[model samples]
Target: MTLSCFDLGERMLSVAEAQRHLAGLVGEPLAIEACPLAELSGRVLAEAVHSPIDVPQNTNAAMDGIALAWPQPVAALALVGRVLAGGRFDRPLAAGEAVTITTGAPLPKGADTVIMQEQLAFPGAGQVQVSRPETVRRGQHVRRAGEDVARGSLALAAGTRLGAAQLGLLASLGLTGARVHRRPRVAIFSSGDEVTAPGAPLSAAGIYDANRYSLRGLLQALGCRVIDLGILPDDRETIIGALRQAAQDADMVITSGGVSVGQADWIKAALAEVGELGFWRIAMRPGRPLACGWLGEGRTPFFGLPGNPVAVMVTFLQFVQPVLRRLMGQPEWQPRRLTALAAEPLASRVGRVDYLRGTYHSDREGRLWVRPTGRQGSGILTSMVLADCLIEVDADRQGVAEGEPVTLQLLNDFS
Candidate 1:
């Protein structure tokens, strides 16, 4: 069946419906590449990684203490030898014998329990004394072999984004590199004669283009390779030509404006002329006119964002971000969300999800509360700067009263 991306007759899609529709069209992940451990952070794994050997490699001491066989009814033990990290005891312990063991040192053979150093004393040369025999616990202060990660077991699964912890695990496994999906190459552009690039003289009524810069940063944060196509004029031929060129080299294409269903919506018309249009409008605040489809031969994904600066940010965060993740080989990833008590009444209308820019804070008592950033006008770019999160009001909610709980979609992946 053919999917229509620019059909003016289709009803406006809801936020969730739009997301689900885009998810299916994103297709398979990009090609795989081997990234070194140092370059792996924020990259998605392409295949499940298995540990070559057991973590810790053997039963080891977790604390600096004396290790001995426990519950054997021993009155005392003679200290046979000492072992530090990276050192091993030469011989096994006989009955009623102990070894001084440091943290991370492999346990001497036949030793099953560890007593804290403070709980033991040297009463005589080569003799150890347990001051608190009753306090000694069996099998204490020992990390068993494969306790953390078993040998030949899965360590990191495919589609997992590597972070500090994951990198540390790979390092612990003595690996220098692993297979990861290549970062998606996204071609971004803005349309409108009034949209002027920075460092260029601003014409009368011209505004500096902020969407391109912001889009670059957001795309980079998601580990995408951004290809800036610069600002295109309102001419249909030029827009269509740039999109066709982008599809040749880019995995996806995004435009900042000219998507709404109006006579001036040139990009929407261009998209329909050169490619398919999945949906052009969504039932949401700030950014209602969002178009998603493919350019040229359905190889390069396209996103037509709202023209308003704030709407560009809102729609990108709520919609485009997830699409990028899917294209980057991430599996069903989602941004951060939490419920907070509304610090004040929130403006909303029934039958539409309101993505109000909000700042959430914790009170002295550690309770989280949220409130809208003043004046959520789509053109006010500063509101997004001052805000840390998007306060999401459900379509069923008419409005919010003070102290009512509301869901917040955090702007940052928040680590």
Candidate 2:
């Protein structure tokens, strides 16, 4: 089970090294487009956006209160004018003068303090008594100009993913649209004579193709424009032709199955004939056979993944996801991992990194715990549906005991 004991008899690349190689191969961001703010959610910014005007625009009341000028021995003040939101008192306040202002109403000139309406008593029609004058501090309850955002300052930087708060801020700045990088275009397919589509008549040896659909979902979740080419026939000409077409149209071409060095595998051969290809034996369980290269004259990136259902998912999340984000101009995207206590012992090899499907939960004391979701077989697609995360055992670790801390990659919480 160790690296030296591997049957492949060659030095396999660690997950980190393989990731670095893939990262270095991806090209720059695609073209940028001016996208409307209403449709900019999940888009990556291509350029920094600056504020045209100050947020809140002017000094205003932060709460409903009586705006007044506070003197040393504050006494009774006369309510000269009433100001609600969107209404402003024109004239400046004189000594012992006060104005009733609602939340977000502009503070009148010479008004430095505001006392809550509850703290003041309207003794007469025009007279207001301040019982807690000492509680009213200078410049209290006043929102200063440029407090939230100053004019001509950077509001959002490039590569920032637009979300609810970001869009709200842009809307406040009076911007209807923003410049963003185009979404990455992806083409996916599965190759194998045994793989067939669901709802079709199946023989005893035929298995429904699940990798393409799951890959489509994963790509869509990553905001990719996925073109599903379906299952390719197990023929050299058909595989080569499909790969060429995919490379010409997509930013990244991915195929599941036919990546291993078996007699029937044609993915590596097709890649070699159509473009540059490298078959790698990565030191990772469930997903060890991987093919990485470029295709067509434009050099579209290509990835060949294993045939196992779980292997396709693991390889995509760990390898292809980062490359796609980089091509989309997203700089902050990375795999999220957290350390949690293992609820049960798990056996693993020393040379290979293991991603075990697990159900993770938080106890009443807020401690996180994880346990395996039944079988850890690569073809058990149902196990993934029952697990929330993948417990990642490092390449150097042989096994994990109960209560031992282990790093788990969160799979369900995409946001």
Candidate 3:
């Protein structure tokens, strides 16, 4: 169903509802690509993998000690041989015999326990003394076969993003590479007559285009192949031509600074003419005006973000990041939001979801606290740079007082 921008004025969506709607719009994962294990970091696995062999593969020693036969009738046993990590005894140990074994060595046959080297006395060559035979237990300090990962058990499921641990697990299963979804190609650009590119002379009324660069950085962090279309003028035909080309070439199109319902805003008109699009006046602060829809015959997802620098970042983090992850085969990836105590008062309207940029800190007792970073204006780019998190004031609440609990969406390591 198509949602007309004109009728959505009074039917603005809450943040949660918008998330659900965008999640529904995501289709299947992009085509799979076989990536080397070394390059699989941050890529989503396209298939479930089962272990072809046991992780340990065989019974091995877990400690550098003496492998014993257990139930020692005497305190002294003759040392038969030394077992290193990759070597084992040629013959099984007879009674009253112990093998000096290092960690990770295969357990010698007939050895039921391992006594730590520190716990035994090495009086002389070929003779080892156990001070306390009662301390030895059968099956103690032994790593059994298939204990870590079974031969046929599922190691990782589809849609699992490969991190350090996941890649290590796959390596343990003897996999040299993995099948992963290809990175989504995202086309990004800034559109405004007043937006100027860096490294060029700017008119008095012009400002360097920062949104495209910032948006590209965010997209790159999410593993997208970014196609920069540069700055577009506010002319309707020029904007439409660029967007159509982007739609044809990229999996997603993202633009900043021409989506608001102002007289100078020509992108909304261009989208309306090109494809099924909707302009939403979402109940959000910093970023209220957003346009989302499909563009061109390929139906590439298009996101028209606000002009303000901070709003561009806020909206992209909240909306675009998740959509790209889902399209790349990551399932139900949600940003972590945690609770923190407010260090100062915060002003908010009851009907809007306010994202106040703030610097968070932990107290001596390990309590998290957040305080606003100067002004909460949308144009203040420094606020976002100086802040580590966004303090979320819910639409249902009026405001927050000092020491009151507030929810914070993590922007960096602080959260």
Candidate 4:
């Protein structure tokens, strides 16, 4: 696999370079805390969890039926008693004797099998008849001990993100708390005086600020505690002061509409005055002028996204989101990708990776196909709204042909 050199100062870098550097920024995860099971969703496990007991705990009936020995000594069996779930038979099964059992009821001692109720006939006089003796199989409809999970086995490994299924599994283990990393506090803001907030009266030359809102949603989806520092003007001193304070208050800081070459010079100067700039550009479309910077004496990480709405999202997905997952202590989290047949030819160029907004669906024959959203412009927010996935064209390849295999990254990997 090709890797980008992150140390190339001022030189446009590749997406991999930024990813590798940001991923390595946090040497260790944040402090571990034992959160209540109900509040464990979206938190990353700090250590592996083990099952204290066998999942089933006992050999029980998996179906409502008659529990008897594998082989019957006679044609008919005497129905001694009945057992429901959580209840057990008081005596062992005798030769030619059977007990009615409900699902999950523990089998009587000496009984090694169960015949589902549908396969049996009640001949009355306290007897259950097995008309087809050959149909009864040994151990059928029985949940053996430790069938689901063995005692003292690893149930979930460290770095596992707790979601619905994970929480349910922990609940099954009778755990009320889980050791997980604390949520990272991220400070976010938008720059540029020309950018106006939504719901506010806009000047003729001003555009609505979509980056801050969109970034907040993205960060929250990954379980981050966002600190909205509001908007910053084109002043250098104000930018530097705000960044310094944000660095001290938050684990990470992010801004949009600044750090581009020849423009946002105040942001560049502020970055230099406050701390360091890793790089200001990348060899990618939509967000070529992505900035990797650090602020203050603590060297808190910073990400300067593009001014355009679409570029902000593209850069965040490609560069920012990975770091967020890492900072949140999810070492096992990786961007989800899938391959689909391109329904139409996608134009791309070499030397820079292309991410085309596209909607994907499976055909009746189970073939997955993708078609790009109309008008692939950096300022087109509608393109992103209408697209469910991003069609990724490798930097080494020029384009994707119709019906050819195309790689795609989903917009939402987890809810």
TM-score head-to-head 2 vs 3, winner = 3
Q: Residue-wise lDDT of candidate 4 within 1-415, one digit each (tens)?
A: 0114335767767777667667766557778998999899989999999999888888999999899997887878999999899888888888989899999999999898989888888878898888787877788999998888789999998888889988988988899989999999999999988888889999999988999999998889889999998888888889989988998999889998877765655676788788777655677887888776678887787888888889999999988887777777775577789999999999999988888999999999999999999999999999999999999888888888899999999997753
Over the stretch 189-308, how does candidate 3's per-residue lDDT look in tens digits?
A: 899989999999999999999899889878877778999999999899998899889989999999998888789999899998777787787889989988888998877888999999
lDDT of 2 by residue, 115-169 (tens): 8878989888998888767677898999987889999999999988787899999
Candidate 4: worst 10 consecutive residues by lDDT?
Answer: 1-10
Clashes of each: 4, 0, 0, 0
Task: Report, for every candidate in turn, its global Cα lDDT versus the true structure.
Answer: 0.86, 0.88, 0.87, 0.85
- Candidate 1, 1-415: lDDT as tens digits: 1374345456877788777777777778888999999999899999999999999798999899898888655666788899999999988888888899999999988888878888888878988878867777789889999999999999999989988899999999999999999998999999988999999999999999999998998888888898898999989899989988998989889999888766766987787777777665678898998878878875578888988989998899887888778777775888878999999999998888999999999999999999988999999988899899999999889999999999999886723
Model 3, position 295, has a per-residue lDDT of: 90
Clashing pairs in 3: none
Query: Each candidate's TM vs. the true structure?
Result: 0.95, 0.91, 0.93, 0.95
Q: What lDDT would candidate 3 get against the real structure? A: 0.87
What lDDT score is found at residue 409 in candidate 4?
Answer: 94
